[model samples]
Target: MIRYISLQNCPFDPGEELCKFRSESIGAIASFTGLVRSENEIVALSIEHHPVMTQKTLEQLCDMVITRYHLLGVSITHRYELLKLGEPIVFVAAASVHRKAAMEAIVYMMDRLKTDIPLWKKEIFADGTSRWIEQKQSDVDRSFSW
Candidate 1:
């Protein structure tokens, strides 16, 4: 089994990361890339985190998904610090022998990541106003579904 987790301040290439995550024995791979949206005239996103706790939480989440889905490989990458609109914020991928497991695992991982992680986000608008984002009930509901 292969498991990779990273929390960085720099931007990453999802395609390159996907290629690195590929395994010969894996028959299916499911991936997700989350980007900063241009909603509400948002100019940038500032992500903050407790470095140690954030990494630990992500690792634990990845391990749980790998075991629950019987995955052969898993990878998650998340970025902190300020990010411009439309920049990638996160990447998640799962590999398994069957397509269904991989797909479900990806969804589960993403849902968990949205709610379980220690990172916080602040949306900076074009008008020089910014606000810290709060977790949505919808995200909590989605994570609870699994």
Candidate 2:
């Protein structure tokens, strides 16, 4: 199985990354993209994480997904920095011989990432103020479904 995970300050193209996951045996690729929404008049979001710890945590998550779903390949890319409204924040793709496993892996990994990932985020409002974003109960509930 092929796996790639990266947390970088720069932006990434999900389509381009998915191209690398295509293989003869992999017939299905399930993907998800998380974007910064323009809610509450927020102008941007600033995300931070402990470099070493964040990478290790992400790798462990990918490993678990790959094992549970028997995926042929997976890629996860999350960005850190000040990102504007409508900007892409995270991209995940899982490939397998069939669609079911690929789809489930994508959802499982995203749900866990939303709650378990060690990342700090703050929303910058247009009024020149910001607040640290907290994990919501809804997100916890979603993870519980797994």
Candidate 3:
């Protein structure tokens, strides 16, 4: 279930869940969550889906991660629409027999999603100003090094 939740109240990190799921059969779990900061700061973030291509991009990313990691299982979720602060921006959970593979795959998927996925984010300010955060070219370049 490699997916970006897109619009769910996913507060609990999925990593622990994944670990528990695989505990009977595997030894390690890898997970990640992107949170919103405070100071007008957000505790979590919301995601804006690219209606035409976001889901497709996420699927492709999952496939790639699965192949690369040889993971026992995987799960990913992201919120869509006007998500408030402290909400979940994204969640990814993975389980593997080895910690190294799980950790590497987790990092790899995150970098891929941040750069390759077509999802967009609008940073809402306290003053009510909103701006689309541009994808950094350096982010893509960094993914390749992984």
Compute the lDDT of residue 78 as modeled in candidate 1. 96
- Off-target runs (Cα >4 Å) in candidate 3 are 1-23, 39-46
Q: Can you write out model 3's per-residue Cα lDDT over 50-122, one digit (the tens) per residue?
A: 7768777777777778788887767777766666566556778777788998898888888888787777777
* lDDT, residue 12, model 1: 92
How far does residue 69 in candidate 3 sit from its true spot (Å)?
1.2
Would you list the C-alpha lDDT of every candidate in the order shown? 0.92, 0.91, 0.69
Q: Give the TM-score ranking, best first.
A: 1, 2, 3
Worst 10 residues of 3 by lDDT: 1-10
Top-lDDT candidate index: 1
lDDT of 1 by residue, 1-146 (tens): 88989888998999988887656899999999999999878899999998789999999998899999999999999999999988899999999998999999999999998899999999998889899999999999998988
Cα TM-score of candidate 3: 0.79
Instruction: State the lDDT of candidate 2 residue by residue for 51-136, as single tens digits.
Output: 88889999999999999999999999999988988878999999999999999999999999988889889999888999999889
Clashing pairs in 1: none
